[model samples]
Every structure is written in structure tokens, then in C-alpha cells.
Target chain A: MATPQLKQTPLNAAHRRMGARMVDFGGWDMPVQYPYGTIEEHLRTRTHAGLFDVSHMGEIDVRGRDAIAFVNRVTSNDASKLVDGQAQYSALTTPEGTVVDDLLVYRFAEDHLLLVVNASTTPKDWEWIRSHKQDEAVELKNMSAEYCQLALQGPDALRILQTLTDLPLSEIKYYHFREGAVDGVPSIVSRTGYTGEDGFEVYAAAERAEQLWDRILEAGRFGETDGVMPCGLAARNTLRLESAMALYGNDIDETTTLLEANLGWICKLGKGVFIGREALARQKEEGVKRRLVGFEVTERGIARDHQDVLVNGERVGQVTSGSPAPYLKKNIGLAYVPVEFAGAGQEIQIDVRGRAVGAQIVPTPFYKREKKQSAGSHQPSAKTQ
Target chain B: MANVPEDLHYSKDHEWLRVEGDVAVIGITDYAQNSLGDVVYVELPKPGEKFEAHESFGSVESVKAVSEIFTPVSGEVVEVNESLSDEPEKVNEDPYGAGWMIRMRMNNPGEVDSLLSSVEYEEFTSAETE
Candidate 1:
């Protein structure tokens, strides 16, 4: 009987030097927050910009003559619709129509693609894909160890990032990416982020991760965007929760289908045949039984994850993720219940401890960045979560 | 490292108590506040509520989690720090001073001698953290 070792990202030393409060997150030793605290770090991301070391996410490279077909067979989203330089939010669903994992697919070309999966579920996702390959024409490589990622997110992200890269970032649309050099380091710059704000995600070699992190921080110090703050996992969790994004283990899991998680938009059933297509199609036609809904605590208590949700004194569901939204100054959470009780403004109660705390279903995302303030002044792009 | 005053008695749960005659002032230790992060809300019991030793009086909510504050000795609450409702950050700023939570009329003064001394409490917290 022995305790397994926790994995550390390349930026672990940097986070320690900055006095970040470290914690074990999903078997990875990562920083939960810096001395600035989660509330301040959260607010900093909303108002200015925040730098996040998201290197723990797994990256798998899919390449070969049948890469496109293989990806199309595994993921719920249509891979054929993704042009070069485009990224799609998709789910790896089981034959039962339940989610295996939600992942981001980056299409570099017809024969080459990148799948970024959750750190905790990477091994499972990789095995599921490898076992289902139709032929040897598709090759899979686990590149998680070769790369590290950084998310520069918020209203000021573009300004901070422009100082390091010579590429025309303004032309890159949301959910799109380009192969370029950032701070003299070869990297893939994607106009994607988990925070509900405008931002870019930079993926670089693991060896160069520390240098790229330092250079990005140095360039962002005291400029037009008023600098960027180093945010940790706690802030990242709160930010994503406020945006009503689904956390794999929490909001959706093996027992929940993609449609039940309210992510049917990514499930393209009519695009030929794929794994789980028949089950998902049947579910869609039969309609979802229980729907995940966003909720705001109306009473004087903070709802917590795993707490029971009651409707008129009967248990309906349980909270998936709950937190005090710093920018919104409200306590919000997500839960799943019967479709009859899923509409916005529907009354519900979250049993915090023994007492029932008043709550109500609200339309997600709880917070949205004004379109005029984001890049290109285009309409705010919606997330699959 | 948190500041633990030498004149106060402490509980294993990280609460500090200062005795002034029959009335005892209580607040969470600095170590507790530091571990809890930014204190956003405080839920306190009514002024006349009575409690037994080690009973939970209320909870303090931080950005990360909620922790219950316990009574170190059985007593009737005489007064509560009302200002904390509007300014919960005071708990993080001065956990032993302006952030004092409640004043209670002690039912057994001898219970103070049984609580951990400041030196013992410091050693306990340091050992727990290590």
C-alpha cells in the first residue's frame, strides 16, 4: 500500500516562487490560488487580464490518411465541417449515448488533428479512440508530455498578447487558431478560452514553457491593459462555473447523455454514421428526460456541490457545481432535473446541510462579456458548455 | 505564520478566547482566517442564544469554503460584533481584534484553564500544518 505520486506541470516552480497556494487537483499538484486570493484573481480576470497555466490538459495528435474519418466516428461533432485552422467543441460519447469525455478538436489539415482532452480523463479517452480505429491508416500519438498550454484571458487579453507575437491576432476569429511564434517560441495560438471573456490559448513545447510564461508575464506588466495577474485553479473553476460551463465529473458524466447535459448542439446525427449516433438520435426524438439547468441562490446560503436539490419538499436532483460568483456578486450553481422543472425562473430549493435554501433556475451563462468590449466588435460567440 | 497572542486561550478548532471577568470574547484564530482565504460572509447566532461546549454557533463563508465556528465553553451569548455583517474582510485583516465574533457570559470559568495555552496552541497548529 503506497500513495501514488502527484504529477506536476512545467510551471510548478514558477507558481511556487509566486507564493501560490498549491493543492492536489485531479491527481495533479497544482496551484489553487496565489496570495491575491480566489476572489481577487477572479475579479482581475473579469476586469483586466489573467494568465493561467493550463498545461495539465492532455493533447493527443491524430494523423494519417484516415484521421478525419476516425475523428468523425468517435466525436459527436462533425469533423468534416471543420476547415483548416478551425477548432470544435465535441464529446466522445459511449455506445449508450453517455459521455466519455468532452474535448476540443483542432483540425490542422485533413490528415492531421489535435484533440485536447481533460487531464483526468485523457488515458480513458485515448484508449477508447485507439480501440475503435477502423484501420491502421489512422495513427494516434499521445503528445501530452511534449506540450504545455497557457490561457491569457479577459477583456485585456488581446492587448497583452499583441506585445509578444507579430501575427495579426485581430484577424483570428473565435474558435480558430494558427501556427505561429509567440515571444520567439514556436507555438500554436488559438483564439479560444474557458473563461467567458475574449482571450488566446498558447500551446508550446514543454521545455520552453517556463520561458514563454515569463516572457508573457514580463510583456503584460503595466501596459495599456494594466497588466495581467497570475490566476490559479480556484479562479479558473469559479470563472468557468459562472459561465455555466459543464465540468466533466460534475455537470456531466458516464450516467448522463450529451442531450441531457444540454449539449445537443454538438451532436450532429444527420452527418452520416458514427458511434452512438443511433442512441443519440433516439434520445433526441424521445426528448431528454432530465435537463441540466443553471440556478442562482436567492436565499442567504451558499449552495455546494453534491448538495440535494428539492422542489416542493421532494428531492429532484443534486447540485453539480456551485460557487460565489465574484463579478456577479451572487451564489450560483448548476443542476439536473426533470424537463418540466428546467425553464428559467422555475422555483427550486437547494438543501444546504439540513435547511432548504431558496433558489431559482436562470438562463445561462450567468455572465457574458458585452460584445462591444470584445475583439472585432462581433457578436459574442457562444460556448458548447 | 499567524500571530497567536500569549494572553488568550485556544481551541483545537482554531478559535481564540479572551476572558474579562465573567464575559469571554471569542473569534477565530489568525491561522484559521489565513487558511480560509477571503472572508465574504459571516453568520452569527442571536444575542441571547445559549450553547454548550464545542457546539457550533455559526459559520464563516470564504471564497473557497465554509467553516463552522464552535463555542469553546458553554455560555449565553451576550453580544455579537454587528459590524462584521457589512465588513467580513475584517476577519482577514484583524482576526483577534476588530474581528471578534461574540461576547458570552461564561457558565464555568474553570473551563478556561483546560483549554490550550497560546504556546501549546501554536505548536498544535504548526504540527497540523506540517
Candidate 2:
């Protein structure tokens, strides 16, 4: 069979001009790295700033009178608790309490919400959301193709962005957002990202994305800014892995439950009924069958996806995502194991390419958190006096 | 793309064999390494294992995918690269040198004639690219 053709992002030309090695990422033709490679990009993002073009991810806008109420019934998180300019990480689950997609719920206002979903699961999520839209007052519009998104991540992300807008970025607390102009292009800058770093995600008109990308790259050339580079899917994956952030298809899928996936925090039992709430409540009461846990290989060999998890030579569960961590310099993976062996520090073995490698369960977020500047110190004029 | 070394014989599967007396040093060609970016792990055949020509020996895994390694010539595996277990990225860095996968005693020295020459392997990979 012929290799699949890749889908182009808005910044394809820019990536090519920068001499990036492009690859097929979930159908999107994205740069896996510049000439410097994934290791450099990974380190750059952790230490300084890195720019990423994540325009391929789908964005849907939920608006109208019953928008908040409608969304509250579809997702695991209590959407009603989100104030304007606040964003909450959530999951959309099936009636059986299995995940449909993990998403970001950005409450722009009381009646307007922006849902950012996984690229591969976009169509299915849209269909599911629309199918459940029974209220005439709710309007669901897919604006994924209309906007382009960029992530500026690292410790210096705030400094680099502050140079462009007079808006006080320090005041935009983590998981909060504001609408403003970047180089005259109206954009929404959100203080949230998947890399577990201090960063901001900028959403702007697709036509203006190239201009914005170039501007940020140019600004990143300043002093103490050698760390800024264009990151591709390779570095993004490793960064997210080190942060213990779950990938949708690998870590949580349509059959994976919020409880089993270790995302119980997103499922609220006290709130009014939502889809999958009863099943999740029952799981909570009776205890879950399997749990997703992080593990580090104690022996040589890299554990990979779909490998079997063995406890005392008995096949118990399976590995979902595994890699030799670039930062930790050890083979680490996420696996679904029996609830008994899921606790941190539990010993286990992962069958890697037919050989069992010794491993021990560890705490989540394998990477350490970097200190961030307080939002009150840099509040934007529109949000403050 | 780097030129395939003229001193080595190539397999259609992209393995390179450098015959030194009765022993052959085996490694993947530059074309293979470039195609399989950033190799993270290499599973080598056990030392003393015997295999026929074109037989599966082990596998090379990258972050994106995994591919089987094929024996270029029927031989008894005499040694495997132990250094690769700790650092597989060497295959991406210097595929022909320290990244060499195995050393084997060739079953028949005349089998080298059936393998491609460096120039032939270059033309073969170039054609495949187009």
C-alpha cells in the first residue's frame, strides 16, 4: 500500500522555509523538527521558549442561550463553575463512562464557550456533541478551519509575548484567557498549554497565522533567547510524556473510562446529571477494574505501545504509551494494570520486544513544574483598572 | 544523502555487509537510517544464533515506528553491538561505524556476488525515492 499523504497546516510553507523535517502527524504534514532535531527542541522548550503551530487541532464554538447548560450535560467537568476568560480541562465520555475525547473547555462568556479537541477525534466529537444538542437555544459551530492556533511555551514565554502586546501577561493566570490584538491581528491568548510549562496559546484568523508565526520567531531572536525554536510533533510528544499528560488515542480511548484513566478529578458526582455520570458514579462506588499508572523501566530496553504488562510473570495489563524519556534519560511508559499493582512504587515488568524489562510504578508528571509569574502583577487593562 | 561506502556489499533490505576474512560486519546503510529517523532502540540477534540469508534477525525501533532487521547473508551471529542497548541514537549518528549491528561468520563467501555494489545500492535507493 502507498504511504498516506499528509495534510498541510497553515504554516507549512514557513516550516519548509525554516528547513524543518516534516512528517505525517495524524494526517497533518507537520514539522517533526528543524535541522537541530527533537532533543534540542525538547530542551529549548523546557529551558526557554518554543513556538508550535497546532492549527490542525479542531476548535468548536458553543453559543446561545442554553449553551452553558447544554455543555454541562455533555462533559465530565462542571462547566457552570467556569467564569469568563477561564478554561477547564475536561473529557467527553460515552454513556458507559468511557472517554470520547479529552478536551479544553474555554468559557469565553456565560453563553459562549470554545471547545478545543483532539485532531484525530474532532469529527467524532463534533458528531457526538451535535447529536446531543436537543435544545433549540443552543448553537454548535465548528470553527476549526477558520482559525489557526500557536503555542508559545517555556519559562520566557511571557517575556517574549509581553514585548508584542501592552497587555499585562503576568495577570493572565494559568488557565485564563483574554482577547487582544497581536501585531494588529485580533487574537485570543490563553495561559494554558499541554507541555506543562509557563506558556500561552494564541488563536487568530487563519490568514494572519503566517504573519504571526514569523513575528514570534523574529522576536525570539533577542538576547537570552537562543532557546526559542520551532517545535514539531516529536518534541511535543516527548514534552507531554515527561509532563505525564495523556495522549488521547494512546492513553485514553473510546473504551477507556475517566476512572480507569486516572482522570477522576474531571468527573463530578455532585453536579446535576450528565451523560455517563451514573456509570462513573457506580464505578466510583464499586471501585474500578484497572487503572492507568506510570512506570520506569528498571532494566534495559525501551517499552513501546501495546506491549504486555506482567506482574510476577503473569500477564495483567498492557502498555499504552512508552518511550526512553529524553529528559529523565530512562525508559518510562504509561500502562493499564490491575488496580492492585497500580500504586506508585509497585514493581512490575513490561514485555519489550519479547523480553521482559523490570519496571516500578511512579508518580505522575515525571517532569518538575517551573515557577510562573503571578497574574495580578500584569493584569491587562481590559480586565483591570 | 550520503554515498554508500564502496567497500561494502548491500542487501535489498538496506543492510550493509563488510566482509573481513570469514567474518562479516553488518549495519544498516545510510539510506535506511535517514528514512528511520532517530532510532531509539535496536533489538539484536543473540550471539551464536544462525540464520539464513534474507531471514529476520532482529528489529530497529524509532520513535515513530519499528522495522525488522534482515540478515544480508546466511551466517552464525558471532557478536552483537552491546553499546546500542544503552544508546540506540548512535545508529542515527554514525550508522556505518559504531552503530554496526552484528558480526557474523558467513556461510558462503561467494554470496557477496549476489549483493549490490555501493553504486548499485545508491541507484536502487534513489529509484525507490522517486
Candidate 3:
């Protein structure tokens, strides 16, 4: 018998009210799609705006005199270079250079930082962080259960959020954040998101989240066009896939290294030591044997996880994440392949359900955003920015 | 939910079987297609391949995941669906008629009695959540 799935987010009732199809996602009962369908929700986020209940993600607060130093030693990215109000994408890795989880580290101040980890790995990450914090004076607090995260993503995100806050939305630069109020609810509005589009991630008290969700939906109605709709996990996956954003378990796991996963950019060996710096530096200098490459199926067949990857009739690697990109209307996936076959335009084959289908290596970011205003275009007032 | 034709018999694994003299036609039930979502590919047993009861005969892949198709009874594969290679969605569109996966010469015709009738299959699937 199938075990009952775990808890729901604060917006679970609201999702049902909006006609969402709920599914068990990593043990959390979450919305997979709304009545508008995955394709419609995806296009809305790409062309206009979409709201997402991302409360399932894990959040932790690190604070102390040694917080910055503590974080710099634990994560792969060069965290010491981060300025107040800025955030950087980084990875927490095992001693062997394998990625434990990919996360965002937000520098709230010189002495305080916020780490957002994948939901499934929250418990394990918390334990790992806590164990490593032994000598440091830093206070590690798992604030995941206390806050609800909502992502307002796409082109019109700033416009929709502008109506709710007197703080200038345009002043908040990409990957930067500010404290703001949404319908009387205090929130941390950060110009960051997973969708490779301009957006804001709002962190608010869990109890106040439902009201804020309703207010955002109401605010959308006043726009010149129908504004943002609540999107679920299905469109979220497709949107991230099109952007070539890596999903935690599928694209990179504890068994996969950052270098092999094409995330060497996040590893900064020139800086002081980190958890997996030694292993990562060795892999970087020696060159990765197998590398993750993006591929588009030229023929029919949707390559999926664990499917064998063949190059010149020889099995080399396997697909890690695959899907029929709704936006591109073609089958696309990411796989680990021999470095020789990782270049763009190289021919390859994916064994889909035992049949080899033609595919081609492609550049990352299968979809790109049209040129828009610069990230610097958004800045808050001198007092609040 | 799609209707299960009264003449067909279904196994607990969701395969539907139809007896035509000594030969048996095997395909996935309508409930299986609905649950699997858009069928993108189907792998069928090769002609003349023999299998024991409960052995995996082939597999079907959808956008969401893959599931193995099992043989309900021991048999020798007589033929496989050729059109599915070009039009796999037919399994979702018409699972009973055009989506038939294979035909086999049943080694034990007596095993047919163990398959559920359309009425029993409907009841079995009605309690299942999609």
C-alpha cells in the first residue's frame, strides 16, 4: 500500500480554491497544475506574470560575529565577496566534491546570512551545517517552518509588486533584496527567482501568507491585461528546464560532482578553503571525464532520467533530466556524456525505452529572455535601498 | 475515465486481454493510459518471443514515468503493434482497438478464467485514484 504523503503548504487550501491539481511532490502534497493547464501557466510566466507557492523550500538563518566566515568555509561559492543585500547561487558539497545541495546564500548584513536549500534535503543540510558549526559562535536557526515563500515571476513582476509597496520596485537590482510591506504584512522582497526571468521572491510569516496571496491576485486584476495566475510544480519544472536550470536530485545529486555537472563556475578554489575545494580543484585541473551537456531530440522520443546516452554506438553516460519542453515544442534533456561529445552540435543518441533516438548537443539555456532593462535599472531609495 | 469494453478481460496490472479463438490480443486498459498521461513511446515484445506467466513482456513510457507491461499468462508472442512506433498516442486515444500491444498464442487457455470481467475491472479501478 502507498503511504500517505506528508504536510501541505499554507497556500494548499488557496490552491484548491483556485482549482489546482494536487500531487505528491517529494512527499509534500503540492499543486501540480491549475485548471488553466501547464502550457497556459508556463506561457503566462514567460510572457506576463505568474505567482508560485514555493513555501516547500527550506530556509535557514545564520547569524553571529563569524557568520560570513562560517558561510565562506561551508559553501563552494566565494561568499566572502558578497555585500550586504546581495545574494549568490552556491552549492554545499560532500568531502569528495559531490554536490549535497545547491542553494542561494543571501547576505542580509555583515553578520547575518540567509540560506535557502532544497526542500527534500533540508533536514540533512541542517544537520550538516549544525555539525560544522561546532567551534564558530554562529547561531544556526532553521526558519523554514516559520516562513512562506511566494515567487512572483516574469516580465510584469515588478509592476504588479510596485502597487503594494511604496519602496521603489525598480530600485531593487537583480540578486538583491529589501524589506518591504505587502498589504500590511512585512516581507523580504528579493529580486531573485529560479525561472531565468525577472522576478521577486517574497518571504513572509506563514500565518500572513494566505492574505498576501489573495491580495496579489486581487492586485493583478487592476492591470491593463489579466495579470499573474498561480502556477504549480508542473509549469515550474518546464520553465526551469527551458532555462537549463538544474533540478536538485535529477541534474545533480550526492553522487555527481560540481565540475561534471557543469557548475564549476560556482566553485571558487582561488578563494580560501571550502568543504569540497580540494576535490573540486583536482577535478578542475585534471579536467572532467564526463560532463553534463544539454541535448535536443531531433527525432521523436522524450529522453528521461536514467536513460542510456550513446555516442557513436557506444554507451558513454545517461540522461539525468529530460522533458518535452512545452515552450520549445521539442524533447530536450540534460545528460552526463564524454567530454569529447559535450560540444554543441555534436550528434548523439538517447536510448528511450530501448530504442535509440537521434539527438544533438546544444548550448545551455534552451530559452533566453529578450533584451530588457538592465539589472541596475531597479534601485530603492537611498534610505531603504 | 474511459470505458472498458464488456467483451474484454483485465488483469490487476492493467493489461486488457481479448480471446479470439486460440489467439489472445493484449493491450493496456483505458485506466492505465489515463494515469500514465501522454504516451510517448511503447516497447512491444518481438514476434516469436516466449515468456512465462507474470514475466515482463515489454514497457510503455509516458512523459511522467515508465511502467513495465507484464504477461498475464505464459505465451509465445505472435505479432507486435507496428503503428505504435509512429503514433504512440494512440494508446491514450484508443487503447482497446488500435493500441493493442501484441498477440500471443496462450500456452494455457484455462488461465483466462482468472482475469477480471469488465464489471469487476471497473469496480477494481473505481476504487483506484488516478
Candidate 4:
């Protein structure tokens, strides 16, 4: 089959100038790593700050009097509970309780909210939302191409980003956002991250992406090594994996439900009549049969995605996402198994090709950010549901 | 730019062969290591295993991707680099020496002549990067 032309972010030229290895990520030409490599970028993001071009992520604007009602009906979370400037991780679920796409709902006003969906799922999500619109006053616009999202993550994220934006970043609690001028560019500054690190995600107009990117890079480029690393998709994956956050295609998809993927915290079944609520409520009452669990490879091999998960040499399930956790310094992964074998200490095997490798079930969020006393208390930011 | 050692025989697949009598010292080339980034894990065939020329005998996995290590010539594996199991990054640090994957008794040493030389391998890799 012939390949289609890959989409490019506004910062494509900048990435090329930095000598980053570009790859096709969900049909978009994205940087997978720079000359420093994924491991170094991953480590630096944990210790220092890391800049990421996240412009390919889809954005949708939900507006009108029925916006809150419309969002609540389609998403698994209770949007009514969210106040202006707050955000929550939620999912669009099918009637069968399976995920359509996990997204972030940022409430800007009583009748306006911004929905950030995965890059690959933009068109589908738009179609799904438009088709599901019942004679409601809510108007949904796919503004994915109009915005450029950049994440400045890690321990020094605030210190770095604060230089460019006059917004009191530390005052912005986790998962909450504020609209402000960042380096003269209007942007939505949100305290959220996928790396399990306390960080900020800034969204600005797509055309001004290069300017925003350059400003952030210049603001944080301290000395020879004290600066933020310009990270890429490869490091992003490893960082999220170490945090045990679910990747849409790998950990959660149409075949999986919120409960099975361990995202039940975001599934508000009692919020009244949302799609998939009935099925999820039933599952809750009946109890989930299979669940996603984190495991560490006890043996020599690294268990990769799509590898089979076994119990006593019998195939039970497959690894959803697996790799060497750079921060944890061990090979870890998430896999589904029968509820009886889901608890920590349960021995399981991962079929790395034909080899049965020893592994033990462990509690997830494989890595967590340390709470620094000087910064006071900040909410532990949640990832995509 | 990759460091190409002229003393080694290079395979198009990027394996470097150093012939020591009948036993061939084989590992991936400097070009391969530079492209692979950090080596996180190295999976190798046990000693005494036999492999055909151009057949993948093992794999080297980095943080980004996985690459198979193919043999330039058919051989019986006499010794495997067990140290790589613990220190796979040695491949990135020193591809020619400590990262040597295996010592093999080749069925035919003449197959080494069929592989690329230092100049040809460097030319081919430069074209690949372009």
C-alpha cells in the first residue's frame, strides 16, 4: 500500500534543526528522539525539565447553553461537578462500556469547555460527538488544527516555564488551568502532565507555535547541561509507562472498558444517564472478571507489547504495554489477567516470543513524583482515563 | 557519523566480523551502535547453537526500537557474550571490543570476502542516513 503524506507540526523545522529522529506517529511526522537519545531524555525529564511538541493532539471546543449537559451525556465523567478553570481526565465510552477515546475536558465557563483528544482519534471523536448530538444547543467545533500544545515537564518545569509566562504557575493547582499571555502569546496554561511529574501544559495558537517553542527553549536553556531537554515521542512513552499511565492504543482501546483498564476513578456511573453507564454499573455490581495489573520481569527478558501473558504455561491474556521503565530501572508492563491472579505477589509469565519469562504482579503508578516541602502541597495530577 | 574500523569485515546488516583463525569474532558495527542509541537489552543464542548465513541469531533492543543481529556467515556459536546480559550499553560504549556478541567457528571463511569492506560499508551507511 502507498503511504499517505504525513502531517507536520508547526515546530517541524525546529526539530529538524535540532537533529531529532523523526517518525510517523499516528500519521503525523513527529520527533521520536533528539541526538541525546530516549534514555537520556527520559532521565533528564525526571530530574530537570523537558520540552515536548504536542501540537498533533486534537482539540475540540464545546460551547452553548447545553454544553455541560452534552459533555456529561457523552463522557464517562460528571462534568457538572467541574468548575471553571478545572480539568478532569475522562473517556468517551460506547454503549457497551468500551472506550471510544480517552480525553481531557477543560471547563472554561458554564457553557464552554475544551476537549483535548488523542492526535489519531480527532476525526473519529469529532464524528462521534457530532453524531451523538441530540437537538441540544451545544455546538462542537474541531479546533485541532488551530492549536499547538507544548508540555514542559519534570522537576524544574515550573522554574523553567515561569520565566516565559507571567502567570503565577505555582498558584495554578494540578489539573487546573488559567488563560494568560505567555511570552506575548495568548495561551492556556494548565498544571498537568503524563510523566507523573509536576509540570505544565501550555496551549497557544498553532501559527505562533514556533515562537512559543523558541521562547520556552531560550528561557530554559541554562548553561551547558542545566537546561531543559527537548524531548520527543519515545521519551514521552517511556515516561508515561513508568508512571503506569495508559496509552490509548496499547493499554486502552475499543476492546477495553474503563474498569478493566483501572480507570474506574474517572468513571462516574451515578452522574445520571451517560453512555456506557448502565453496562459499567452492571459490571461494578457483578464485579470485574479481569483487570489490568502491573508486573515486573523477574527473569532476563524484556516483555514487549502484544506478547502473551500466561498462567502455568497456559495463555490467559496479552501484554497491553511493556518496556524497560527507565526511572524504575527495571522491565515493567501492564497486562490483563483473571481477577484471582490480579493481586500483587501473583506469579505470571510473559511469552516473549516462545520464551516464558518469569514476572510478578505489582502495584502500579510504577513511578511517582516526590512532594517537595518548599513548593507546599500540590495535587497529584491524574493522567488520561 | 559512525566510526568505521578498517580492520573489520562488515556485513550489509551491520555486523562486524573479525576472523581469528577458524573462530570469527562477531558484533554489530559502530554504525549500528550509533543508530541504535542506548542498548537496554541484548538477547543472544546460547553457546553451541548453529546459525545460517544472514539468519538472525539474536536481537538488540534499545529504548526506541529493536534490531536483529544477523550472521554474516554460517557458524557454530562457540561462545556468547554473557556480559551483555547485564551491560547491554557496552555495545553503545565500545561496539568492537566488550560488545563483541559471539565467537563462532564458521562453516566457510570465504563468506567473509563476500561482505562489505570498511569503505563500502561506510558509503552504504552514509547513503542510508541520507
- Give the alpha-carbon lDDT of every model: 0.89, 0.86, 0.85, 0.90
Q: Candidates 2 and 4: which is better by TM-score?
A: 4
TM-score, ranked from best to worst? 4, 1, 2, 3
Output the better candidate (1/3) by lDDT: 1
Residue pairs whose backbone atoms clash in candidate 4: none
Cα lDDT tens digits for candidate 1, A255-314: 999888888888899887788899999999999888888999999888989999999999
DockQ metric for all predictions? 0.74, 0.45, 0.23, 0.82
| Candidate 2, A1-385: lDDT as tens digits | 9977777778999999887878777788888887666776888898888899999999999999888889889999889999999988888989999999989999988889999998878889999999988854888999998999999999889888887887778888888999998878899999988787889999999999999998887788722547478888888888888887889999898889988887887888788889999999999999988988888999867888899999999999999888867777777888998888888889999987678889999887778664644532221100000
- Categorize the docking of model 2: acceptable
Give a tens-digit lDDT track for model 4, residues A1-385. 9989999999999999999989999999999999888998999999998999999999999999999999999999889999999998899999989999999999999999999999999989999999999988988899999999999998889988888878998898888899999999999999887887888999999999999888888888833487888999989999998888888989889999888887888888889999999999999899888898889999988999999999998999889888988878899998988888888899999998788999999887778778773333323222222
Model 1 pairs whose backbones collide: none
* TM-scores of all predicted structures: 0.96, 0.93, 0.82, 0.96
Fill in the DockQ of model 1.
0.74
* Clash total of candidate 1: 0
Interface RMSD of each: 1.0, 1.9, 3.0, 1.0
- Comparing candidate 1 with candidate 3, which one achieves the higher TM-score? 1
